[model samples]
Structures are given as C-alpha cells and as structure tokens.
Target: MFTSRAKIAQRLLRRLHGTNATPLAKRPARPSVTMGRALALGLGGAAGLLGSAMAVASLESDDAVFTNWSATHSCHPAKVYHPESLKELIDIVATHHAQQKKLRVMGSGVSPNGLGFSDDSILTMSAFDRILHVDAAKSQVTVESGVVVGDLLSHLRTHGLTLQNVASIREQSIAGVTQAGCHGTGAAIPPMEEQIVSMEILTPSQGLLTLDDPSDHRFQLAKCGLGGLGVVTKLTLQCVPMHKLLETTTLYTLSELKKVHASLLVENQHLRYMWLPYTDKIVVVTCKPYTDGSPIGSRISDDIEFRLEELRALYKQVATVPDPDHVNWRFTQLRDSLYALDPLNARYIARVNETEVSFWEKSQGSRVALSDDVIGFDCGGQQLVSEVAFPSANGSDLTFMEDLLARIERDQIPAHTPIEQRWTASSRAAMSPASSPLQEQVFSWVGIIYYLHEASPSLDAIKDAFVDYSKLFEDVMAPYGAAEHWAKLEFAPRSALERHVLKDRLRSRFPLEAYRTLRNEWDPHHILSNDFVDELCSTDL
Candidate 1:
C-alpha cells in the first residue's frame, strides 16, 4: 500500500538518474529587465576589483559548483575559487587568512545552514578532485576534498567500491558531507564519518597532518570536525564492494506505524518513513541487499513527481492549506497509485521537476522557477533556518513529531513548507551534531527543521521563539542527550553551543584554545587565520 507520492517520487528519481539528472525542459531565458537590474546592482568601481579577482580564479569544471542546492546558512560567499592542486589551495587559504578575510569552503553546497559562507571568499575543492590513491588490499581510497559523491560513486562502481552510507542527496562533497556527519537510514551503520579510515588536515600552520589510527579515540571524533580543526585536504575512506539494494515502500497511519516500528527497524537492513506533519498517513521505505538477479536494468521511476504534482494541485485547490492536521488526512485519502505501478516490479522509470521552487505564483495559477529571476522569489531578500536533531532512542512513538506539529500550529508560525524528519544512526565523530559525550549507545535521530520565512519579524521575537520552543522540545529529549544536525539554518546559542557539544566535553576534541597553541606551533606569525572561522567561532577579531 505504498502511496503514489512516495512510490512515484522513487520512480521519478530513477529516471532523473538519482536527483542530479535534468528534467526534459528548455532553459527558460532570464527576463531582460531582471538581468539588467542585477548587473546594475553589482558592486562597481573599486569594490568591483575583488569580484573580478574571484571570477578570474573560478573553476572551469561544470561539476565545480552545484547550484541546484540551497544555502543552508546565511552568509553568501562572494565568489567560489576552485583550486586544482594542494599547493594552489594552500596558497589560497594562506593569502585569504593573511588578509584577515572571511573564507568558506564549497562542496555541492547542500546544507541549509549558514556555516558554509563568507561575503568575501568561497573556496572550491574542484581542482583537488581526484582519487589520489587506492589500497585495494586495505579497501581504502584516498581522495581530495572536492570530489562529488555521484562522481565518486561512479568511479568506485567501475572498481567494485562504494562509501558506507550516503545521504538522500548524493551531490555533497566527501569532505563537506562527512564534515557534518551526513548519514543514511540503517541501524547498524554510523553516520558517514565512521567510514573515514584516515584524513589529511591542512592547518594554517601545521601544513598537513595525516590523521589515522582509529583507536586514538580523538581520531574517531575528529573525523567530522566541521572544517574547524582545519581544512580537510585529503581523506582515506573505507569502502565496500558495489552491491544492489532491495527497497520496498508502503503506507500506514501514524497509529498503525507505531505498532510495527520495532519489527521494521530490527528486521530490516535500512528503514525510513515520512509522515506529513499533522497527518496520520505515513510513507515507509525499507531497503536491503538484493542479489537475486532482480532484473539488472535501470530501476528508474518518474511516477512520484506526477503524484507530488497531484498533491501540490490538491493543496492549491484547498485554499486554506496551512492546517497540518487537515493536510495529513486529505493527502492520505487521495489516490496514490494513480501514477505508479506495482512496487515490486523492475525497470522502473519516470521524470520530475527536481528544482526547488517557491510557493509564489507569477500569473493566476502559474508558478515560475526561483532561479529564473536570480534573487530567488525575492525570498524576502534573505532568510535563516534552524534544524534540531532528536534521538528516536525512546521509541518511534510519534510523540516528538506530534508535539512539534501541535506547537507550531498553536503558535501560528508561518510554516509554509512541509516539516522534514530524516533518521540516521548515532555517530562516533567528536564534533558531529549527533554525538553524545556521556552516552555510548546508538541513538535514533529525528531532525526538526523550521525556516525563518521572513526577516521582518522582530529579531528578539525570532530568537526567543527559536530558543524557547527549541529548548522545550530539546529539554524534553535532553535527558537522552540528543544532538543537532550541523549544516542546518539554526544553531544553539553560544553558551549552549559550548555546553551540549562534545567540543567542550572533549575540549581536546577541537582544542580550540589549543588550536591557538597549534596556531603558534604552525604559523607563529598569525599568517593564516580565516576570518569566517574567526568571526563565526568568536575567535578574537
């Protein structure tokens, strides 16, 4: 009984070649007026000098900047510089850090958090994109930080190798993805960071230190160091032989889903389900190893997009669609298989509009792509987002999600988008948003996302609501020591940011103060302090 939405989405995904494939449509031309205005708005005269310097150094690779993604964080890097070699990257970091300029790294730019931005310099690992070496005997592959996941997977596929776990989107960089401990659905496997056998950290001073020896204790934690310890120049990853996955999708009510939670998780290799907030209908997907010659053909499907489009159409017709409760029931009753075939069938395929679009309509009942105008639906100029991660350790009682839905409705927040809750097993990374200092058990994570739709709200109002509501939900789960996802739009305040995180419990984890010691050890002249890191982390100006 997998509903049409989930099933069609899966089929559409197969045709899209795993999310990056372009839809069969023409590139809509930019409005001349919009283009002229944007060019006019560009910083000209003396300020334009910096912009020009960036353009000259940008990467020539099409795979260089994956713009299909959204900015999780607030800061927009003025320009993205793609370095082709370690020496060049080192020079870029050195020069920017020397000028006390803010520099942020770009890797597929998939996070919804503002952690990856600087108004001045954006560093791209595109040039560093290569499989430097592979030890078949050890089952490890060393790679530069800039390599794309799909590209990495395709290359590995040729040699019978794959990363341990990948997030829903395979467009993230190996460095950036693991930097925040990105993960997939699986009880036994930890987040992506666990797959790192070793890494080469390029500190402003320490040049490059090959971090290995998983038993070092600190090594495990530092694997997802959020580019804080230093820039990740090279990584030695543990890989498995490429294998096919058996996946099944089904629908259930929230009440019904609770009954089978244990059986679904304990009995399956990978399990994940999504329930539209305030709705009883749940879409459950389970994936496991499949070797039964399951029609070795492309398992593509476009039917999901058709179903999602149907859902969108339904939402449009309802006029008053904000009530999550109503949305849930109405969406469930709608036909699901109107677009898809039997879930067990092979040769699945379909297309979709994977591009992120805004809710705003241009003409009556018509919508336009956000990128068409460049400013992105005006998005009210800019917005901030905060995502908190809670553990499912207590059980998938639906209580956490249920409570969240109620609160948002009670407060009447302008939550225009569907709330997302993805699950990942606990991580062993020291600085990951999903780690607990005092506990050593695997925790099921529930990620809560709230987009600050408009900056018009009073700063105090926004901050208070974000902190208070989060604390309420977080406090209830704090006893379990739930961790947060690193790359989202919201982060814990300063005091709490230090307290709840292992970076404080395990000060030796990042050695921020000791990094000062290492800063002196490596670059005594203070020649390479990145302003983005300095300002964001509150290192002395």
Candidate 2:
C-alpha cells in the first residue's frame, strides 16, 4: 500500500519546502517520468538521508538563494541583510543609496508574485520582530515589520485585544500582509492595510519617513505601497477587544447564493464562499462575534475516511496507471488521480468534480472558536494560486464569477475544487486592490488555484493547463475592471508589447500616476524596486 510511503512523503515535502525565506535548488529537467524529481523532494533517500540533505539545503550560505513560498520565483542577492534595528535598516539603505544599488525589502517571503525579488541587495527585517507596545487605552498594538500575524495574535490575546480583521495565513508578516493589502471576508470591513494607523518607512532620498500625517500625500500611498516605496520598519495598528466568534458553514448552489448573497452579507460579520467547479455547490462560511460564548451547530467539516473511501472506489476503477508515490496524490488525490491517467479531459474531470461535491455534501457545518481562529483558515500547500479583485458595486463581480465558472465548464478547463471568493470594503491605500474613491464600494476577491506538487507525474503539462485557465479568467475579468491581488498578481514570460499591455492594464485599475510620482520623489535612485515592480510603474511606459 502507498499509505506509509505517502505519510513519509508528506513529512519530507514540508521539510524540503523550507522557509527562512529559504531557497531550494530547482530540480533539473527529467528525461522521463522516472523519479520525477523525487530525489530533490527528498523522496528517493530513506528518511535519515532525507533529513541530512534538508539540513544542508536549509543552511544559509555565502551565496544564499531566496525563493518564494510557491518556488516559482527565486533570487541570489549580492547581500541579504537582516537589520536588527531601525538605525541598522536605515544604514543599509543609505549605503545602497550612496552606491546607487537597488534594494528590495522582503518580509516573510509570503508573496508569490515576485514582489520582493532582487538580484542586488535584499533586505529582510526578520531580526526586527518585536511587538513594541500594546496601548490599552487606544486598543492599538505597535509592532516591528518582521512580526508575523500568528505571533501578534497570541500577544494580542494576552492583552485582551485582537486585530480588527484577520488574514488567511498567520505565518505572513505584518509588513508583508499590509503591503499586499491582505484581507479577511467582510463587505463591511476593509483590508488589513486599512488597519494601519501609521507606519515608519526607510526611503533612499527621504531617509526615514514616518507617515503619521494623514494629510500628507505619501501617507495613503505608503499604507499599501506594494513594498516598493521603501522598507516598512514599524507599524501601529488599530485593534479590537479579543472575543469568541460563532462560525457556520452552509452549503448552497450558485443560484441559491446569488438569491441570498445580499442577505448573507448583511447578516454576517465575516463571509466567504467556496465555489466548487464542475459542480453546482458553493460552501458558505460565515463568522460573527458571539458575546455569549455559546457554541452553535455541529461541526460538519470533512469526513476524511469517507472522502478517502469514495476516492479509493473511483481510483480502483479509473486509475489503471501505476506509480503510487506521485506527490500530487494526497489532498487532491482525485484530481491528480484522474490527471495521472487522462489530464484535462472534460468527461474525466467531471467525474472527479462529482466526487468533490459528494465530499462537501457529506460535511458542511460549523463550530465556535476565537475570532482570529475562525477568520483565518487553511489555504492548501504549494500551488499556482492567483486572486483577482474587481468591482462588486452592483453585483458585477457576481456576474463575473458566474461567467468564469461557465467559461471553465464550456471550455472544459480541468479546474480544481474550490474557486474561493471573498469580499472587502474600500481601502485608502493608493495601490490597494480594494482602494476606491468611494468608501462605500465593495470588491470581490476571487482566487483561482491549481496545486503544483513538483513530484507529480505530469507537473509540467498541468502547469501549462493552469496557465491557460488563469489567463482565461484574466481575459474574462478585464471588462469588469478587474485587478490582480498585489501579492498574488502574476507576470509570466512576456514580450515588450505584452509588458506594455500589462502596464496599461494596471493603469486602468490602480492609481499608478500618483504612486509612481511618490515613488520617484522619495526614492530617486530607484533603490527600493525589483524588475517586476519596475515593469509596472516605469515612467518610460
């Protein structure tokens, strides 16, 4: 049986995908499917040997490589500075400024869009992780840039305070989260970036810029500056009292959700939908603060054994192909199981989608928990995931989503399980995806995901399919004034014309002119940018 080997494989998968913002060497091209980079994933060796190689790969070196969480982007910087203090951070920037060298500030490496990639100087403030102060009177917590969300929440719980909203992942740094304009689900609540009361930035020409002055033009721009304006050293966030929350997961079809989405938005403090493709169901997850602390609803989460049995039955019939150790066979065993045989076939994919719908039907209810715990949930491991934000002012986003799913089925795109949908109120941050002149407007953030387990039998081909699927969404969302989420925005290999097209796309959606003006004025040397950033805001464009 592949059970024992699969368990060991998962253990090695987690270790091999290390993060100090660590970098792993990309596996060389395979002549065929044999091993399928299993050695690089630590699957070839026994567990002992696997542990040794992981240590070696994880150890920081003189020429240490920096790879993002997705392993799609990496950089070997000339210097990786972990500045311990604000003074130290300023000094590094000042030196780089004097040398006319570029610097890209990296937080916890949570961004998958190459937002922090630089071949020059890479700055990580991992050493500057400290919760400076918790103001009891104001309900605010001051933290250094490197302080991650998980740590901050634990500290906040002790102080009887929590963030106004939560992000999907706790491992993300406060700086990274805000810069990306990360958010939770709520039409009434703005993104995490909107929570920042003030921030201290280290710019090249300006030196140390403390953007507390709301009237200042740079203040709003700096809040969600896409990590390009400068190195975010410190932030003060407005917090709320820590409390228990009641969460409920209710299932609905797309038509049902459309009929009741307005009511759902009105009733719930936190709301998000998990729309399973090739099926008629959408998993509705709603959370609200429960003052009484009484738990409601039985937990209707996944019955793993039941799910496994269904998949096993299907696999026994359809999975004639061998090679049980394929890495993609775990969380998405059904998808990979089918893909291992016939990839992207509409008829075959429908069978897998039916299995997913069955799993959701068997388990979809909720329980009570802390506000933080309920807000942030699991976003599956390693994949090509991208979220596009578009105006939902008049249910336009709803129309867009319906059209997207229709397109997927019509085009017979071998789509994944959940096309997770979330909503956020407007943000003042100039570059925030949800930023708008009208404060009352709401935007929908829809994530299109395709898991890319490296040791999968058909990783390359499936990745190509994902690219096509994602591009289709981008094309469809364009008319809806859609903008890619800053953190998950993607830029693949492109021509000069395509690059210009991308810049034009952003120009239509974001306040690019103001952001670029501030960027140029503050960092005249362009020390705080990478190629991906430069591509978008370049004056030459």
Candidate 3:
C-alpha cells in the first residue's frame, strides 16, 4: 500500500509543526483511564498491604523517551513498569488485563515505527536480562527476553556457542530482534527467529505458557507476533558452535554486480553490497568461515576521516543560514554535491574502499574472531531509514534493482546515501519480509537511508526528502511485490491498503488470516494493540 507524495509531504510538515495530524476516525482512542487507574490501585494496594515478594517500579511521568535509536518516533505512556522477575511481570500483566488497560512491550526501543507506543502503559523488558541455561553439548542457550545480543554473544562464546545470525546493530535485546525478524545477509541463513527452539510467552488469557514443539502451528505465529499475542519472557535458541570468520571488501561497478550477482550469493557464506547513488561503483563484502592459510594484515586509511571533517564543515555552513527556506535549499545543494562526486576521483573511491575495508579490519579482519564481531557492523548515527524486501525467487534477473537505480537517476531524487543490498534465505515466520513457505531459496533486501547528522538543516527537511524518494521507490517496486521491513520506517496508510493488488499481495505473501485468528483468540480485548499494529493487521484491506 502506498500514499501520494504530496500527502506524505503534508503529513511530515504537520509532524514537524508539533501537531497531531492523524485523522480522528483512523486513530484508535486511548483506553479509559478511570477504570485502569482504579484496577491498578486496587491490585497494587493489595500487594503492598500483603507485603508480597513481587517488586516493580511504577512511573506516572509522561516525558519518558520511549523513542527508537534513530529518535524518529516518540511516545508518552500513562504509566511505565519495570518488572525484575517473572512473578512481578505476571502480576503487572494480570493487573493491566483486569483494568482493561492496553499494554505495549518494549526492549531497548529499537523499532523505528510506533509499534511499541501505547497510551495506557509501557512495559520495559530490560529487567528480564538473565541467562537461564547453557547446553554446551546441544549448542543451545536458554535466556530471558531482556538479554542483549552483545551480552548473549559474550556469554555464549565462553561456553563455545553462538547465535546463528544477528542484526546490523547488536544492542537490541534477543526478544526484540526475534520479534522483528532481524536478519543477516546470507542465502543459507534465515532470520533470528528461525533459530528459536522454544519460547515462554505470557498471554493475556493464557497467562504464562511455553511452546516447545516446533511442529505446533502457534510457534510460527508467536515467533514474530509483533508483540501482539503476548510478552515473550524466555526463549531457547538453537545455536551453533562458535567459530571465527574472515571478511574481505572489494569495489565493483554496476555492470560487474549484474554479472556476479548470482555467483556472489552462492560463493560466500555471507555476502552484502552497497550501491552508491548517482554513481556506477558499489562495495561488495564477503564473510566466510575462517581457517588457517588466510592472509592476516591491516592497512590504515584516512580517506573517511577526511570526508567526515569536510561534511561537518559543510553542515555548519548550511546551519548558519537564517531563513528556513534558505536552509532547505542549502540542504538540497549539500545532498546534490555529495552525490554528484565522480567515482573516478582517487580520493572519493579511496574513501569508499577504506570505509568498507576498515569496518572489517577493525572488527575481525587480519585475525579470526567471533561471528558477532565479523557479521555485525555499525549502522552509523541517528538516521531515517526505509528498507523493503522483494522476492528474488529466480535469483537470476536484476530488473527490479536496475529499475530502482534508473528511476533514482532519471528523477534526480537527492539520494546521497548508499543503497544497501542484502540477501537472506526464506523464513518460516509468517510476518517475516522474506517469508516463503513454498521453499523459495533467496530474497533480496534493499535499504534506503538518510543520515540525520548533527549538521543537517532540520529533521523536517531530512524527513521530507526521505519521503519524496521513498514514494518514488515504492511506486516503481510495487509491481514486483515489495514488503516493508517491520522495524524500519514506512509511510503506508490504511487507505492505501485498499488497493486490490497490494491487498492480494499482502494476503498471499503473509499468513494474515491465521495471524488475525490467533491474535483474536489470544488477545480478545486488544490489550497488546497499537496504532501501527492495528493498521497493519486491519481486516478491511
């Protein structure tokens, strides 16, 4: 589903002006506070009077920063709760369920959308960080949902085990990453959720339940439940033996990418590429299982260091412009100048090569290290990002990618950031972007990013530019059945879902009917629902 660029621009302006522009009819009304507060007071007072062992801090302040890492979306919950134990978490959920108060579960608040935003209450799972068990023999780890990816990796490494894959950013909690279907680049590897052997979910009705059977249909629904069905407390993930990896970075032209695209996916254990907009050059990175005999050396480069300084200076000059309109114009000029640089320039190409080369070199190159250090890379500072996944069932043609690049060039979309292209095997999770129950082997993910550096003119200007380019991207890729990444930024509205083609695509691509049924059966009162989830799960489409 898509919206017109003009409407998207108008919406961005309204948001920038600090106004609630969402239509009243479309916005879900916040739950009644009188009933919620009364129930909360009753349950809480009873527990305090009884001197119950369960302990949790309840906050009423509405100024909490429940925003994502990018700081693009923020929400103010009527109450925020941090439960340190399973009993405490259950008590909180039961109280809210009785009070008819909606709840949204959050973990490090990594989602770029409003998926975790709620007016009734917000439950932070960070307190649940505990490694329950480590089965070194089976190569599996059982941990609480709050365990951060980095921490889990370190613990697992001590026991000679590691996760199968991780997102680009390893700060996200394990539950958060799995729920959002976070994935790495590899044709043979699936998203993080696929590694789950079992999980303990606390549903509003079922209370605390464990799904240990892989054959159970509910496992597929709950694995990527979008925090709808329940709160994930603990998960048992099937990990692999810890091993080191060797990574290499190389630059290639557009023509070269087309020729080697097929081989690249199969040749390396992990492969990803970044295409520079308005240029024919791209950077390809390959990570494979490291063994003896590989070369070990590191070369320092200052190309990126120099470019960062120049960018900082340019941003400073643009920010000094007095008029807002002039600031916008200057920002446009900055983007154009950044994108128009010739790839032939020794310094420019050197900078691109160094950036990629140094990333691996600093992390794992020149020496074998854990996969977490090798596969994961910094996503950069705060930025606005929109990533979409399209099925490359055939894995041969690059028409969709070629058309996207062509459209950006023809329209001169002011896209200065590199377009990242990655591949992943099909996922069994119904809501996964790369979901293909029919046994499709490969899928492609294309990410569009607009970095909101400190020197940027304004958040509004960056958002406007991003929306403009995204609308064009959506229009061109819609024919190929593209699906937005759940954790990334997307502007699709409910009205757009009414399109027959998009509606059919979504229905077929995702098990929406089954998910709807499971959600209704488990969360009949909609306590775990939010505006984003509601719109996305709407049956009207």
Measured by TM-score, the strongest candidate is 2
RMSD of each: 12.9, 8.2, 11.0
- Name the best candidate (by lDDT): 2
Steric clashes per prediction: 29, 0, 0
Question: For each candidate, what is the lDDT?
Answer: 0.49, 0.72, 0.66
Cα lDDT for residue 124, model 1? 54
CA error at residue 175 for candidate 3, angstroms = 0.5
Question: What is the alpha-carbon lDDT for the whole of candidate 3?
Answer: 0.66
Which model, 2 or 3, shows the larger lDDT?
2
By TM-score, the candidates rank as 2, 3, 1
Residue-level lDDT of model 1, residues 1-541, one tens digit each, is: 0011122222323422112332222212200010110111110010111111232354222222222233223333455465545777778777765765655665545565544544555665544556777677777788877666656766776566777677765545678789877777566666788788888877665677788985665466458665555678888899877666655556566778878887887676666655444344555656666665454333323344433454455444533433344334322222221112111111110110111121111111211111111111111212244445555665733676666657655654323223444455566665665564534444565544333322223434544554555555554445544555666524346475544453432333334564444445545544333343443344422
Clashing pairs in 2: none
lDDT-based ranking = 2, 3, 1
The superposed Cα distance between candidate 2 and the true structure at residue 161, in angstroms, equals 1.1
lDDT per residue, candidate 2, 404-484, as tens digits? 989998888877767889998988787888888888988898998776655457777877888788778878887888888
Error of 3 at 259 (Å): 2.6
